[model samples]
Target: MSEHDKPGRIAPYPRPAGGWDAIKFSAASLRQEKVVLGNLKAFLKQNQPHGFDCPGCAWPERRHTNRLEFCENGVKAVAAEITSKLVTANFFARHTVTELMRQSDLELEQHGRLAVPLRYDPTSDTYRPIEWDQAFALIAEQLHALDSPNQASFYASGRTSNEAAYLFQLFARLYGTNNFPDCSNMCHEATSRGLPGTVGIGKGTVTLEDFELADAILIFGQNPGTNHPRMLGELRDAARRGATIVSINPLRERGLERFSSPQHAAEVLAGGSTELCSLFIRPSLGGDFALIKAMAKRVVELDDAACATGGERVLDVAFIETHTVGIDEFLADLRQESWSLLIEESGVPREEIERLTQLFVRARSVIATWGMGITQHRRSVPTIQLLSNLMMLRGQIGRPGAGLCPVRGHSNVQGNRTVGIEERPTAAFLDRLAAVYGFEPPREHGLDVVATIQAMLAGSVKVFFGLGGNFVMAAPDTPRTFEAMRRCALTVQVATKLNRSHLVHGQQALLLPTLGRSEIDLQEGIEQSVTVEDSMSMVHLSRGFKPPASDQLLSEVAIIARLAEAVVGNRLVDWRALATDNSLIRNHIAQVFEAFTDYNRRVAAPGGFHLGVASRDRVWKTASGKAQFVVHPLDLDTPIHRARRQYGDQAMVLMTTRSHDQYNTTIYALDDRYRGVYGQRDVVFANRRDIDRLGCRPGDRVDLSTIWDDGIERRLNGLLLVEYDIPLGCLAAYFPEANPLVPLDSVGDESNTPTAKSIPVRMLPHLD
Candidate 1:
């Protein structure tokens, strides 16, 4: 097929109110198919109970209040799970791995859930059914055959429960390697690494209840409306209460602009979308660091003004003096930063910056929330630290209405990290783990996702095992990631459905089908419930209601247990017992980590419990027992220039994003309703002048190539252009499809998060 003929290659943006149309469009799509309302009804009721949490977003539930707790995307998530489609051995027999690879990610997922354990036979290029025991034995043999434990890398998805993740990490460590690379490396590694230096903990310090009391909410780099629909209700409620909600993002996201909560009966019937952001500040792509630094400078200025007037110190003098260090140095660095640099870098006018600063100064309490946008940049870690520093200056931490909120993507992503899923495990944590498990844990830091892929390409890594994730597609530089997976001696995936990662077959691969969170988990003739931690540090239990789609499907814990037994035969830990009883798993966790003391008992309560954020009590965990301010000398090596260069004409920096109808890599439909895009996912939204400058018209074919070190290139033959209210020198496109263009080597300086938000790309006429 020609490039132009491909779906998503060339399509026009839909008219405004496309979201309203999408509600109809999706309904039509569902009407044509058999609806499984029974499954959905039962599944939603089991949410936030003694079961596994929803694998979609990290938005907290409202204390299990209503019968209908599912959001719009949550509906899509559960519908995708309860999908009538199935990919059995027969389906695999019909299509070769190569043939499946040619299909789109949507088409791959549409093939449906894997009904049984399947092993890839390279000779036939098809996956064949394999017994669970045989699958475990094969994986054990391949891992054991590796020259060293470092040659094996363990990848995890955010979907895995805390118990399952704990066991997976324990098993990997017991096998003698810290090569644990996870999804966090690709998304929020900056927050995970940077927040600890600013606050006492790596996770968010606020609870869901804090939103109700917050006087001001500053949302940075997050589009909660689509990515996290449930958050809209909270934001809407906060807005209704007259709290100032400021949105800081490069794009004017509809979610941040306005949201009509489907849950709100009055608004839903009246067709009214509540106004969300009181002030929407659009910063340039990769300009978050500069903008935050400017905000901190403003705070310093405000502090000086208040001191000169003999008024109350606006800089939280008490908090800083007691719990922080290096403020003087940070102030010096802020004063030295030129206004011209801040204006040029942030893409926001000086007047607008002053206006935002004034609002911050006026607010008595503030809550700062951020997402991947801030984390996927060159100075991601420092940017996060700066935000934390700003919050500290305002005395935001430890209060009911003020704190730091890092909007985590997955339901259990935070939980996984909380329970021994770190690439760099501290000596203290390892010692505790050793004391609990009765074995010396490896002291070496493990490889992250990017490092693991690089090691695999370098042939230093051999076996690859994913607890739950589409690592090949989710990772940056798809071609390289896929090649690395194929080069592995053995690949094992524990998943619920068929995805692009499954098609990227290894020399020998095994697909261990696992039960989804919505499905019932029966073990040893008893029902089981899994636990997950939210982004706000609230731990809750999740109980499944609907029966398992496949009788052969096993819970994640069961799969891990079987693998551990096969690999570590007669090991110190009782893997089988832990799998059969999650309480025992919690007991082991409590023994290892102090934070999880009385884990089993505490989790049995209604909403579980709070993990306790030490920073909330004004405790700083830095070297001097106080929050230390670190200064970064700005690198002027690569300045933003619009002139034609060796790479290409100085085009806009394109930040790939997910459409309203999509989540992460999952494409439910080909429509970004909020952006007025419909029946297509390949169209690029750009300012009208950009198209004219390139001598291209709407629906013109174009190729986008990144000028990054890792030779990764992506071209979309024809994309329908749309004139939008976007800032100059900026472009927006859909993700996962555009993920291939983001090079593996182009990562944040300190956090190593793939720079998915800031890629310098050039646009050109499509070659016939």
Candidate 2:
């Protein structure tokens, strides 16, 4: 049985506490929303340029023209970071770790900003305030006592600045551990791992400038309205200019349907939202490979027909000859794919596939963009390769208005990977580091996020240090993750706010509060700026404006510096000097990484610089020295169910989703306004036919359990059913709430990302 099946476990669905009216009341409370425009403007100007990067999504800035670059969620993210509210020692003194664990994620966020360093005391069961020196000294003791560096894991968030990230990786290596488990492991690990094989670089090949010139755009498995709100503006402009924009996702997200940019005064006043997606393709969860293959097969047929009819060739013959390899194999696989199987798997008609292929064949330039939905799957890498292959067939790369764009969530997630947050370090990167930094970097591949958790569970990992992410709660299989964290000898979190992960205690846990991007970071009596790499691979400077919420709070850089000093000693590197002056940190970075050459001078300019994208110039960095096409054959075998011997029937597939009002792990409110979901987080969206087939109706409570090979069973008690326009035999529900049903072992084929988007489950009535 799954952990949730236990007697005392909390049910996945919680009854609506105050009802829809109460939720509406709470949402309406923001109508008279106190505008922080003045503060925002001043802060944007003073802090944005030189401050730490925003911890939100990695969508690029609009040329840094005006100060109003941030979005609503960005504001909340910033405010949450630079809030006046403080979580002092007194607050933690009153509540034990166990008590805090009982609080909802929203309540934990509402507890406000963490103000000082805290250490959990087992006797009192509360976190008592500890001095920074003491905290560092204690952490040092644990690190020193570790039998081997491999026993420790260093976890990082995408929010960390380039300088901090560089220092973090350096510290991990110098400390003798390459076990760097980071945020990338959970989200775009597939993109990082798979893209390099196809395109020389793991990052997106396109720049923001490419978006303006594209004739056609394909958005796959991403909702811009909620996750990356600012991107909606770009899509709206692109759609307005007559660009063909297609959206492919499991849900018919309203964001892809229409968007009224709050920035567009006339549009908002007229109650008009711009029409987005010219065509919306609803594919089955984890069915991207099937969909893309069907499209590819159609493209090949069109190419052959064109040649026979004295028409222009659909495929870019010259580009293919000069810049790519393995096309024949890929094309053969596509040609072999059966239309019936594609139709059944993709949940899209063959006609729709032809239409999409025709559009691709006709477009002069096309940009393919995708989000976590594509990356967080079993065939994530292969799916990405398929996208690259589709683009290459039309000679889309190495030109304006056409390329691949991976829409990352964190501000510097791409940057972190760029600067060396990876578990797998290249020999060239290590050689450069040794030549410049005077130390041989670890060559052995390190553990990723999943591997780290598994290591901890097996008693192989002892110390856990997170640079700035919520590890426990954000990871899949919460019960296992929490227990693994608890098994650690020590756990250290460098963060800006209180999260559930903070309460997932170790033998000794340290909560080291840090300054946010919106706050002034004073270093050595001089104002300093931190750099962040955006989704488009543009490296820009971010400076903060408001004074820090607490004087006790340290910058992320300072915390890392102190920790490094305590653990690695002053001989390896002067941590104090580097912390005192960010310039020193940049200089050190420049010495080790060739990409950051003259980092200080380049960032001093009005607009930050773009990291070199090799694909832009047709420099393929793959092993074959050409863009490679990978073939992924479709597998249609469904696992047989032993329980079905007693009652024969097909199991349903459920995709976990997020509400419009929520960000990853942080629920802003209960209402999912865009989808017409109100004050109800426990409702599951299903097709009316499916409900009837299951002997249920709308508003019926049902228990959903996963049908996995392992005898694990997860149930969501009292989940209200809502009839929706979803496909038959398919179900959708919000994540974290439904996360319990996803087994940690049920991960992506190559990426190791949990298949949260596609889980097979059996349902039962809520008899209790």
Candidate 3:
């Protein structure tokens, strides 16, 4: 394990996004990954129309002809995926699981890609190489031996292809369980749960094309510079087009301040960058609801003032009447909202809200995009509703340049759910699956990620299988999730690299290495191209060109099919043929999903096809048959309100974020160049005022304890606190390191997504 034992270096970062730093860093990544220039050139075809999708983010490709579509983070992801480094059986022989567990999260993943199937040997505390057939057989035996199908839990990741995800869900349902715990359950479950009821679609209403025409774009609770670097390009472009870009977050993000696109040689050479955000608002953690509501109120006020003088109405009256429902009640609720409470909770001045209101009033087109910040709170569903309400008020949905965009994290996360990787399957979908596959599909609701954690803790779940992703690092309540995983009789991780999840194993664990997005999968001499849906509903084919890093590596589709064959034994489904030809899998997918009517033909086209969203067509599939305007009364939730009452007003609201060098759970580099922190993950970023208030100076060593309702007292000790530009009484730290502070039970109202973005913690200076 490559541990960052040395203290981190915090320095001043003078330049904006891009410039020489972008070029230098990307070059460093290629060098670190030991990629040959030829291989690197081939890998650079990522996200191309005829090439593979970058595993970094779900940001859609602009066009096939765009010289450089990938971003800095995308390059890092490609370098990591196509790295020359390998963690083979020989490497595993040198280290035990216990010994590996001692490595830091970043170090554990840097051990390199898993090259072969390896099973954990509990007696030796080491991983030994195993044959694929025997490994699948062991998993099948354990699963079959379970008292009930529900006793086994299956997890899918956002990285899984649409074909693989479809097959995985199909396998689970055929096996008589809906126990699908997926990455979506942790990230954007709020959007998945909140959007459909309102807009008839869970995905973003705006397309990549919309970015060009937007008058204003409001980004909330997300940092594009680190998490989704490609978005910074779009933001830069939008800003250059004179769009008013507004940023609402707990901490000021560099990407929002300004961006210099490395793709533009002139900008890099001249050190010139575009200022991205017109107005940057830092709301307190969990203050998004109040902020959104207040914005809505101001918009309505502006509309009323215009209507009073018999002037042009700010609200789209005709569109509202024809396409919306429950607006009257929603407006009433907004009108009655308390300004004092909203201002206090949101931590935004009334004048700032008024300024945004004026911008909204003036703008004819607006797109409100949000990320984990708005979704990882207790009131996420309501907060999303507030966003939807704001959009619909001005008839943003179905419009040319305005809509609701929930920036999805993974490359194909939205598509995974689109292709049926959900715990709660719709009866219509199940019926279609049963008819197509000639098997009785599971109708009962299954365990999501959090519920799966609880099930594992109860000792009911014996077999745990993950298609992709590092679950241990991704899940909240890290200690508890690890304990639950350990309770499983057998655990399986079908992945690209060795992460903390592989080391934190069950009684018996299997590390089944699989092909990454960058690697080609040929079955029966024919190369395969898998499809992935972007943040928008655009479904495109991703064809890998590079050979597999290891001959032993199998594609995720092959792995899932083989496992299903071993376990369920292809009575109704031809798992073998599906594995051999991906087209057959797509055909089967088309048969079940109406959106994929001509899936094969459409995907074969140049840029693939869009799954024409219903809301985009102004045909709502919702219960109302119109866009629904739902209102949530503004108030602090029980947990947060209680914590503030008990721990005083100074209690810091801790938010676990991705570093500049990370993409979700994968750490590409140790340095957070944008935040000016290098070679460490143990440091916490807090406000200067808060540090002074707590009687601490910059770089003071501290320990943070979660102020939980259950009083479990989850504590992360020996953390170095750095006073920085965050809201007072708010702290920012990178995740998996801070995952333990997020309680398992702390979830959103309807989404049930882990509240990883907001955890109430009290940090004290370490005397030692």
Those runs of model 2 whose alpha carbons end farther than 4 Å from true positions after fitting are: 1-52, 637-649
Best-fitting candidate, scored by TM-score:
3
Report the lDDT tens digits of candidate 2 across residue range 1-768: 323223222232222112232234323323323324445453355324444455788998755556556555665565566445678988988898888888888778777789889999999998888999999999989989999889999999988998899889988888887898888888888888888888888888888888889999999989887788778878888989999999888777776777766556576656577787889888877678889988888888889889999898988999999999998998888788899998877888888888888888899999999998898777788888888888888899989999999999888988999888889888988888788768877888899888998999999999999999788877887778889999999999998889988999799999999987777888867877788899888888887777787999898889999889999888869999988888888898888777789999997776688888898789999889999888878765533123234335547778887776677777665666656676568878888888888899887888887777776666777788877767776788887788887778878777888777777777777887
Q: What lDDT tens digits, residue by residue, belong to model 1 across residues 1-768?
A: 322224543343333221354355445444322446566464446355544466799887766565456566766776677676777888988999889888888777676777999999988999999999999989888888888999999988898898999999999999999998999999999998898877757888888899999989999999887788778888888999999999899778777777766556576567776787989899988777778788888888878888999877778888788778888898999889998898878888888899888888788888999999889887889889888887877778888888899999988899999998989999999988888778998998999999999998999999999988888878888878888888888888889888888888678999989998888888888888788988888878777777888888999998998888899864698888888988788888888888889997888887788898888777777677877777765545542342224544455677888887777887776767676666677767777788888888877767776665444455555555666666776777788877777788888887998888887777777777
Q: Write the per-residue lDDT of candidate 3 for residues 21-94, one digit (tens) a residue.
A: 77777878888888876687754578888998898799888655557778777888898888888999999899
TM-scores of all models?
A: 0.95, 0.93, 0.98
Q: How accurate is candidate 2 locally (lDDT)?
A: 0.80
Where in model 1 is the C-alpha error above 4 Å? Answer: 1-33, 43-52, 638-649, 709-716
By TM-score, highest first, what's the ranking? 3, 1, 2
In order, candidate lDDTs are: 0.80, 0.80, 0.87
lDDT of prediction 3: 0.87
